[model samples]
Target: MNFKKKLSDILFLDIETIPQKEHWENLSSKEQELFTQKTLYQRKDEITAEDFYERAGIWAEFGKIICISVGFFTGLDENKMFRVKSFFGDDEHKILSDFKDLLESHFSKNQHVLCAHNGKEFDFPFIARRMIIHQIVLPKKLNLFGKKPWEVPHLDTLELWKFGDYKHYTSLKLLTHVLGVPSPKDDIDGSEVAKVYYQENNIERIVTYCEKDTIAVAQILLKMNNEKLLEDKNIIKV
Candidate 1:
């Protein structure tokens, strides 16, 4: 069963991350050894560790979050507007700290919950790990220290689609396409995020892409409840 929350109480979010350094050579000897050892089985025998380093961004320990975009609805029905804002830059610490403040200030309540696509496995844990690494305190919404699985204040669009099949996996792009939510991959996809950040050095483009995914998560939630999809005009980028 889909657990429904008031539209106004849910915060839809997405994050973009990149490898800590631009290239494999940028990592120290010890870090490279650690990376190779940990990823050996996952990379298989043919692909060298350096050749597989492009995937480092998917792991929080080897990567840093560059952007976090969030959207939430205000008002009801035809008057509803989704306000989106992004915290992004080359400074990972500042980005994490700023996101923590936003969570503590606006979304700090038992009634409030966070919703994201595949957030349970990826987005939520990645943010929490980066916050711990930076020595920033976790906000109520993100901190799962003593909370039971049922008590966690989070909603994952991917999890909802699973319907008790633990092995079922789906990408946000695929889910949105099948569920009739407007596709968020009009610009860049997740695989190209690292290249765009390191080679192209485009923070604005990343922020735009991240925000679109966040909006798509929101639209997916609405679709699950048989609500209308949001129009472009109703999506205000703050």
Candidate 2:
């Protein structure tokens, strides 16, 4: 797919999530039992299900999005800008609400699309599940009730890199490095997100991490199209 035509039309995004409850004990006994069963295969006999609970954030039912960072292109070349914005905080409802507002207001057009590294598999469905849980109306972009595979208005950079090889998977950090894009990982990576949010109680750090990933995603897209990557001066944080 030629990304040049749609470069300015995509809302590049990334999200950071944490377990809904701070600790494993915070879950109801029934929830705990379900969690154990849900993770039984992965957890195995090596680790107790409760011990693996920190990773519950990977699942929508047990996780909540703490932050959603988005970036979009604007202006012409030489004056081009990739403006970044974030909807985040303690309240998941407000975050989802505000993000929905963004989709409806500015990115509601037919040409507009949502993007992320592995969004179609994780970010997109996770957002949709949480929105349903919170009773938020699904935005047109996230609502994929009956759309055909090719009809979905979404893009995954990871998929682009796969080149139709389903078994191949590459981390966003690795992709950036190989493509000569600046590394987004100055501090914590995704594995440390839960700790930073829970133990450190530092949401701001997570926001910065998410935003950097957002920028990195856009840069990767430009690289794919053989376009020049944006310089620091060209990135505007909103």
Candidate 3:
């Protein structure tokens, strides 16, 4: 594959999430108890809708969106470069709404690929769910529903690393280390994002973390395409 052409059709994205607050308070006592129980277990498969709703509610209150960072890399000016843009939102609804619009406007019919690290399982679905909640239609090009697993056009860095073993699962940070991408040295792992966002109102910190992850994704893509991975210092802030 021509690296330049492929890069032109790629967009890298990442998001930051926090737990919901007011929604949790609205649940009845039994529902609240279920939520409390599920929180203790942290097992999605064993939970019921009531439990899920309560958890989603808890996430909704403190569940502010810290960032929706994206990178659009394309061939331009006879030079290969990537343009990075990020959307930061303290308001979850508005942030997700804006992200949908941004994606719809940029989406094209040229076989572009939406790239993310572990996006198929998490980030992509989260975005899709938020769009549904906001009554926003996803761009036609991004409709991954019901597609065969192999036929799905969206590329996941983590998925690619499996490399036919199908049993090894590695975090993006580990892949970054193997590929020589500098870790952003972020203090907060994703599990703590909700706590930090809600309890501390630390939106900026989360945004920074999201940006770092986006950069890491871009670097991984560079390695996949056999290109000299550019340092993320060159990434432009959106």
Kindly indicate the candidate among 1 and 3 with the higher TM-score.
1
- What is the C-alpha local distance difference test score of each model? 0.92, 0.93, 0.69
* RMSD for each of the candidates: 1.1, 1.1, 4.4
State how far residue 77 of model 1 sits from its true place (Å): 1.6
| Residues 1-238 of candidate 2: C-alpha lDDT, one tens digit per residue | 4655567899999999988998999999999999999999998778999899989999999999999999999998788899999999999999999999999999999999998999989999999999999999899999999999988999999999999999999999999999999999989998899899989989999999999999999999999988889999999998
121 Cα displacement, candidate 2 (Å): 0.8
Give the winner by lDDT: 2 or 3: 2
Off by over 4 Å in 3: 1-5, 22-64, 76-78
Measured with C-alpha atoms, the lDDT of residue 182 in candidate 1 is: 90
Model 2 segments more than 4 A misplaced: none
Our tally of clashes for model 1 stands at 0
Which pairs clash in model 2?
Answer: none
lDDT of 1 at 120: 91
Error of 3 at 152 (Å): 2.8
Kindly list the per-residue Cα lDDT of model 1 for residues 8-74, writing each as its tens digit: 9999999999889889999999999999998998987789999999999988889999999999999
Q: Which candidate should be chosen as best, given lDDT against the real structure? A: 2
